[model samples]
Target: MAQRILIAEDNDRVAAFVEALLRHEGYTTERTADGIETLQRIGRSVPDLLLLDLRLPRLHGVDLLKKLRKSPVGNDLPVIIVTGVYRGERYARAAQSLGVRHYLEKPFSANALLAAVKDMLPSCVQVDAAPEEGEPFDRHLYQAFSTGFSGTFHFEGKRKATLSFIAGTPVSLRPGFRHRDFGDYLLQNGRISANEYDYYQGAGHFRSDVLVQLGCLRYPELLQEKLAYLTGELLEAFSGPPLKVEQRSFPLSPGLQLFTLNMPSLFHRGYWRSSAPDTANPFPEEVYGQFVAPAAAFYRHVNFLDLNEEERRFVSQLDGSRTMAACLEGASGITPLLRLLKTFGMLVFAHEPLSVEMPAGMPLRLLFNVLEDETGPGGDGPLESFSDLVNEESRDDEPLLPAEPPPVLPEIGDLSLRVRQVFEGMQGKNYYQIFAMEQGKFSFDQLKTHYFKLTREFGPETMMQLAGEEAGMVEDILATVTTAYNTLSDVIKKERYDELLGSEKVGLGQKGDDIFQAQVQFQSGKVFLDMEEWDNAEKALQDACNIAPKNGDYLAHLAWSIYRNPQHGSSPAMREKVRQTLNRALTLDRVPSAYAFKGWILLEGGQDLLAEAEFSKALKLDARNNLARKGLREITEKREQEKKGLFRRMFS
Candidate 1:
């Protein structure tokens, strides 16, 4: 039988969430909204564990616990305090004295809540990703996707991986640390050939764009394959012998590209390869005659598998006057359901303990399929997992890359000019503006997402794109962003940054056209530009340029508007005037876009050689200059780069 837990919380939402999470982990739970109700329930029906919330409707949680400690019924019951109120050492000490070893603050994660609960009353499976013979890597993936966990998964052993998440979704496999051989993963998996792997290995410096040029690999497909490979690697870590593992809350990196993949769908490849009891008949005749119960709340986090009508009916009838033998007799065509439930370990027989027993032989990748279950209790002996074998060999030899660690990317590592432009523009921007947050909006985690995104992008270690003096400017920009994040993060400093952004709003009736007002106009113009209203952008940017002509960003954007404006004819004369405007803008400040605009005009003028030079200059300043790079690609008759998703485009 699943262990019983009692939830004592006054807040309906908190109570509901905690109850659902505990039930999902295969526990029977009871909820009481007040201390009086809590005592009555605990006394009447003893519980295996209790989740106590301090502030109760009828009686205080602390006082109620005191009464429980004095009584025989409630004494020695394990309790974990899940509180939104009554925090601090005083309250903790009081609870500790009352035999509470666990304390979780409100707004906790599903992982944290489950971890605390599992520590007190572990599930039947005990698949906590340690040395135990558990379901291969699939369970870990299932937990992350199912619970919507957002944090870092860190593990170290013979082989390990570090992954980043956002809102429980896996975004990047490795954000900043190690660089593994993705080609080997592909080659060994038969997605690519040895020749292709060798060629890719030789072209270590080639990026997605150049790979397209060489007709070697398509960037998007390669990224997708790499994601698959990393997913496999992460699974392999847990599939093998014991490894040290630790998890902490961490945000996704903005610089890395995130491609969508249905993570649940990726698990079948690993699950069948895991160690499990082999059975021709998963439900033995002797056990079928006995009573059975749901092994877990398996209904949740199982959308990847659909429920058949008969299967649903069979599950609904598990309450009374039913046995596996009866169900098997009634539903003559439910072999698939039986096998599915068996694979998932979703049913347990009364008084029969289940244990994880590994196959005598070593496991092999892709060796066992769903069909293997039909082969009966003693299927073929397992072979060593193929991917694990190859990966182990690859780590030792690494035929492609030098035995030494791969060198840092010569061009600012992973930091591109596009990334720099995205962050550097927010150098002097206020906390709200930098985060693009509206007035009076704050969540420490939300703020953390924006903060991690910016700081990780402008990391000083990867600022090799800039020279010594220019790099100092990047550092200053990083410092400014750091300061803004710190100020907003602290309750006291939140009142003002180094300077307040009170007068930062534009289009209001403000006094003089100072640099501050020009800044307002500039920001408003950028918003219009993002909205693609060329005329409005022109008018607002014209105001900013008139007030602050030396601001190259302002002048360059105004030139962009002049060129984008439909009223501005596409005649050679108009093009020439826009070209001259960009030249003037570049003289004031050499922003990448001005050179990119000049390059585009030259390209349109059929000055291919001159256009290439301008494009190169734009790239030198900002390698991610889309306009410049696109112009060069057009010159060389190559493919246009794929557009980024709105979030990445706007944020990164």
Candidate 2:
């Protein structure tokens, strides 16, 4: 048997990468995202080695290791501690007493990890791996879980269902079976006698809750049974005609998660079991021209076990230019690898990354800083940095400023004459002029390269040195350089800037004043939408509509904003007005949003049939509209429920 290695790490990304590395080395791996699950897994089946992270939920790693040291099974288990915690040497010393033989710091490479595991499990067996990607549905799922990833698995064609995974174990599933309630589940599975179920039904206060409260069944045990039953159902449905399967990496939120059966083990419990499909290239030739990007959560949990030598080489060379063709020169197996990566959703296939609209939109600099603040070192939660900013501003009595005020006064004579000349004259120049480049001439790649070079040569530290002071002046100029890059790099922002610059050159009159005003308001509304400030969005989009009443896009956006704003009560009057606005928008232009929002209104009014029709119309207009697609899904689910209920009534 292949030696099984168990990874106890709360960081999903780190855990996944480690698992992938181990799997490639021919070791079977199981992962737990928290201390509680790790203990349970160890109790159920002992692994050959334990790769542990110190910071874990439910139980701390040092304490858990101490507990394990006292256990018969874990007393002499080979252990390695891998974590990013600062000053973790203190923990290392404590773990050493408990027989943990090795400690690897965060950001360690694959080779180092492989070496450590190999030293501990010298006799581990290796097997030739089956094809891992772009396969039929069942094997794709098996490979995903076996690699120790946790997230939502989506099957987007016939027999669609979305299933949630926690550390390679099935936890929850959506689009649940028809007419399946706790009572039906219990009775059908013979968990409870019919008499017992009838008795519980007579008393009638949530059957499961009552059973637990009365000590007739333990909550944990009951939940486990429930999850097992659901998992069985999901696996059975996995045979739905060769559909497209996509897996996404989800960050495990802080909590004590309930136990779930590992998918591989669950498959062995008699669900549809099958081998992986034949390996033939599924990607089109044009796929090479598309850019591939890592998903948002991929940084934390990346898997490269499936890639071959050539694929590995090509992937390592990805320089943010996702165009596969650009990097595929002389590379073999690159096309199949790209298809696999795209199928697994490890990388996003896009023509280009979407750019933020100008005006009212926060520049990419602020956006990235916000992202870093949330996901960066020591960051605790989503929008953590932005929340801190809001809290700080709320506590202070000062007005919110256009820009962050300088840190403190610094000396001006600190810089050399050349640095001083660059700083003093930087603000007056246009972005292109500041970059010393001509507009419509330089490519984005060229602009990015130039920006990097300039920042490196004349960075903020360089300016501070030249100024001979710690004043915020140098930082201010650095900010300008950053702003210029932001304006020049984004496709939409750069295009708008070019248009404005060209207009200025020709001295165009205010012939399109209304159009300009409407655009400004529309952009503002979009920014509000991005921020989830529905009230502000409504106000801004309302202004846009007022400025250009005939623009169906503006009116449709305004209608959506109004519908989303909680301040506007969902009274009959409000609903009627929203409907009227949507109708007007459709009359002006038959865009998908007008029909989609009209469906939303009708759906809210309990007109399911009408709403379904409207949604269908929207999908006809724009098949890829997610709003319309979701609306149709909801209606279909409701219809399924009614059909199930009718069947139950006739049968029962």
| Clashes, model 2 | 10
**lDDT of each residue in 1-652, candidate 1, tens digit only:** 3466788886777887777667556575667777876887676556778898865655667678778878898777788888764445655665676788788887789999888888876532346655533333345555666556678776564335566666666666642111244655554334455565566667744233333455444454455455555555554433343434467875656554443444433443333222221223456768877665555433322334323344444554443234566545545434545654665665667644333222235231221111111221245543211212223455555573466885453333123444555645664545677777765676677777887666555543235234454454555555446556767877777864423445353454456537777888888988998898988999899878756756777888888888877877634334544655665577558899888887876666444556778899999999998889899889766212211121122223
Off by over 4 Å in 1: 1-139, 174-180, 187-214, 227-238, 252-261, 276-303, 306-321, 324-652
lDDT by residue for model 2 (83-186), tens: 66423555456556677667788888888888888888753333464422334555656665656667888866433567677766666665442113455556
lDDT, candidates in the order shown = 0.58, 0.60
Best by lDDT: 2
lDDT, candidate 2, at 602: 73
The top-ranked prediction according to TM-score is 2
**RMSD (Å) per prediction:** 28.2, 27.3
Instruction: Score residue 394 of candidate 2 by CA lDDT.
Output: 39
Instruction: Quote model 1's TM-score.
Output: 0.26
